[model samples]
Target chain A: MTNVDTILKDMIIIPKGIFFRGSNASPDEQPIKQILLSAFAIDKTPITNKQFRAFVEQGGYDDPTFWQPKGWAYIRENEIKYPNYWYDNHFNQDDHPVTGVSWWEAMAYAKFAGKTLPTEAQWEYACKGTDDRKYPWGNKEPTLAYANFAYDCDPTELVRSSTSVYDHPKYKSFFGCLDMAGNLAEWCLDNASTNYKWDRDGKDPIYITKDEDYHMVRGGCGLHNEDFLRCTARDYYPVSVRDNLIGFRCVVNNVKEEEL
Target chain B: MDILDLPQVEESRRMVCVCNWSIRRTWKGVRLATIIEKAGVSNTNNYFLKQISVGTKEKGVYESTIPLEDALSRNALLVHSVDGAPLPMEQGYPLRLFDFGLYGYKNVKGLSILEVTDIYELGEWERRAGYDKDGIIRPKKYWMVDLKGWGFAEKPGEMTDF
Candidate 1:
């Protein structure tokens, strides 16, 4: 069995609460609405190259049981053996957040860890908390000190690449989730929708589709500007396209009400 | 060759990124066919055109390879201006190729070299990441940055639903 300690050690238990979703910043983020989310434990930081190495070494990619049917077919058809940037020296450091992973690969990794990708509501709540904050940290705009983003970092000290997941000590969210603002945008469980125009009120609202369409990605990446780094900012990518700027964190829903 | 010295076409076109976002803007530049003809290059072998870009430190050198027929199409343009202004440095400054029928990756930014070859060379993103070498614009729901919302491209190829 894969050691549970590595995946569960730093999990932060977020209390059940209501947090506002969406923002007026962009049309996609319009008509801010309150979303209720159940208590869930989230990884303290994004899954790192070191953490994912275990999954790869354990033949996570070769196992079909861990992946959805469509995802499995895609991996087989594309002959995907590992993350897209698996061998790239620039992004292959042990502690850097693992990127170049498609949404399906992320889903497989989550399954391998016995966890699930966070629903968009859970992810937003984890970052925004009870208060409606513009960013993960607070209302203030992002500087390099807050998050790793484009046009912000000094080129001398850092190359234009993802830093170690442990680098941003100050960019923690309300629920103590680190690297939630920028590093690599995290994948959420929901399928891509233009806006929150549907009925997502009340508790544990998650959007899924019968079709294997594009999936949502949240937080921002090292390559995007501050506008995309906001907590409410959203984007999507095809399930099979492995991008270097996208990574993910996993979460486990609390089973016991008393545990909350 | 100075691209600005060649014949230019001022037209508006849509550029769809493989990431599923797209934008439409008025572009001003010389056609790839015009530039090729002015350079006195022969494509009798139906060779592919390899485009290289002066890419940034973050992205390295961006590259794209297009079939000779597509390169000579009326829509294949080496864009220098967008939306009535000089192309922003981030948008590839002086010159960038906009192959309207293909995904944005095919439109190499900050173009530096144009080589003719018979072999099908994979572009930078296709080589580094696992992008499709063809880079065609597929019918999909694109997050239209210009429209500030999602827009569906009902048909494939160049998105002309203005």
Candidate 2:
């Protein structure tokens, strides 16, 4: 039996393979395709406000060295002091998923943690699991029991579940990761683009234009309906834009000596 | 053309223009004049106002606004129908504000509240990164120049030429 500390470990191993991505529910989500991913590690859960608070306490904002040039500019222009919803009472819980984090903030946290955000491909591979199901669980339609969604109760209800994040039977992935399908929307490293070719090309990642910087957010959130919880469903909002339903998970690439 | 059911608050008077294709579909709903008559505008010079659209999710609120004159125009209607069909989810059903001259983005979707204020406030995307506020649509041939015969190029220079 795994101890609580062992179960809460950072990196989750997702073996590489092609999996179907994108929902068939809408025209925009049409043309689902098989995506092949190299094996990688992803965070077991969404980043928490407590972790973000530690970053902020470390003067993440004041350190230019920690952020990319564009990220720094975005931080300055928005004058973002904290996650948009961090002021809300939900943040009091250490286990609650952090919201109000911009894509930039999420990236900063990943960097601070000595990790990187997973690419869209990596994210889809992890969420789809080895069997290539429609959601983390399987092809079955999502219900409230499978995920926290549709604002069934107060927005802060999920905070109470932090201590029990692993207890939920539906939280387990085929690969044994927790909460890949729902809880909060997770940010990916990919720049938001509609073109499949753009998504496939790993080098020279494209940044969404300033107007559409609301980059791609994957997985579903507590606010999402069953329809939005599809494993391949894609949603995006501006990078600087923050809200309570949005959060992120981190990924780390394990490099061997030869690769290094 | 029933106008009463549409939420006719004072802030509904304004609209924002996104792209230039401002096709006017028949919007038979409450007029800005009717809404203003009821809500009573406190500030006239503050043509620019912010419109916050609340979605089913509490955090799903999308905020935007338009010029006062744009908001007050006769063509501007609290549109309940598009082409006589109830608006679909893609079309901002139930109630949407449509302005004849403004681009599509100015026509906010899933509207919930309209606040009338004097501040020339930038909308969400605008305030964050100074995104294009003009809403002017420039003609372009195509995002992808040519799809036909597009294939792998052996040389990088050949790909560039293509």
Candidate 3:
């Protein structure tokens, strides 16, 4: 009946706990920290072209109710009519994961749909769970089937297959999320920081939200024959920037069992 | 002017792209500030150049800026050489940038326009995707491959052109 009721399907619930936040293999990832997050509901897959199309068709771009103050200004300045790839007249189908939307666009989509982008902390907790299991499916390495990477095709494509969008048991995270490792880098609601160690604090930890350099993008994509597919490899881009490799999923504060 | 003709410094570091992947490449080139200086721009101090912008031919991923403080460091360069050879074709050849503070995306490739402007712009990668303008790595390690070894390639042998 409402946006919350319809859009919340296939949303996975991440429980409250102290999950691993960063890795020790590199400088930025160094000083592995523990984050305590309350329960939340995250979309099983990154927002799809078909889903986002509904938002645009519903006047999402024109509606001030769906946008924040700065986001509205950004959309106005860029005159962003729709997803960048949409105008290219490519991947017009409904199945492809939407790419080329900036962080503001992603946030607006979330707000329009009554959801929010998960922070990088919540993203890691959902993907890898409490321990260091290595990936969403398990400790195993990724192949073509597990998540989409190392491919030479165009940027936007289906999330492997129609069934894999929210049903593929293998691609699901411990909290039942799909495409956590590859497919597309999902934007998190955190700023990119070299000193992430100091930013770690408990209770719905969202870091570098204001006066920040870059917003955070999690997960990996088919672009770059990279080790970026690892669950811990966080990436970033400026707020105004857009890319073919970028897309995002949405999350919500977990309601009580009776509320659902 | 040819980048090779400018004063060159050997820049070596375990470079990591935005994807949280690492590559150890030794590059030689002129400091980005030096390149700006050779272009006849006066007052190349970091403060004045903080608003400096860079434009690349790559689309969607548009303009970028260097806090001239970072640009002045011999660490950042408009590199033409990597590992005693011309910059590889797979890599951004001819002239590519190195941002000591930002990720490899911040180290923009296929550079086209270099100017001092007030417009706050993002790289084509930064613009198209949500990459950090500051080039700091995010805390999550959900990387595609592991350059530091997760039974993954521990060296440049793991790098690819995709």
Instruction: Put down candidate 2 lDDT per residue, A1-260, tens digits, no spaces.
Output: 35422322676766555566655555435466666666666777777777778888898887777787788887887787667666567543667777767778888777777787877667766776657677677877666678776532223554532222443466566666666666677887765554354445343233445533546777766655555566666665556656555688887664333321
Compare the candidates by TM-score and give the number of the best one.
1
Q: What RMSD does model 1 have?
A: 6.1
Location of the lowest summed lDDT over 10 successive residues in candidate 2 chain B: B136-145
What digit string (tens of lDDT, one per residue) describes model 1 on residues A1-260? 33554546788888778777888777677577877777788999999999999999999989999999988997898788888788888888999999999888999999998899998888888888888888888899888888877642213335556788878777678888889887789999999777777645557978788426778889877766576678888877666667777999999886356544
**lDDT (CA) per prediction:** 0.80, 0.59, 0.66
TM-score of each: 0.74, 0.63, 0.71
List TM-score (chain A only) for every prediction. 0.92, 0.80, 0.86
Top candidate when judged by DockQ against the true structure:
3
- Please list the residue runs of candidate 2 whose C-alpha ends up more than 4 Å from where it truly belongs after superposition: A1-9, A151-170, A195-212, A257-260, B1-64, B67-75, B78-120, B123-162
Clashing pairs in 2: A214-A237, A214-A238, B13-B71, B14-B71, B16-B106, B17-B103, B18-B103, B18-B135, B47-B68
Write candidate 1's Cα lDDT for B1-162 as tens digits.
677777879997888877556788999998878877776876535788888898789878887898877657635888999999999987888788888889888778888888877878878877666566777776555667777666666565888885
Candidate 2 similarity to native, TM-score: 0.63
Which docking class does model 1 fall in?
A: incorrect
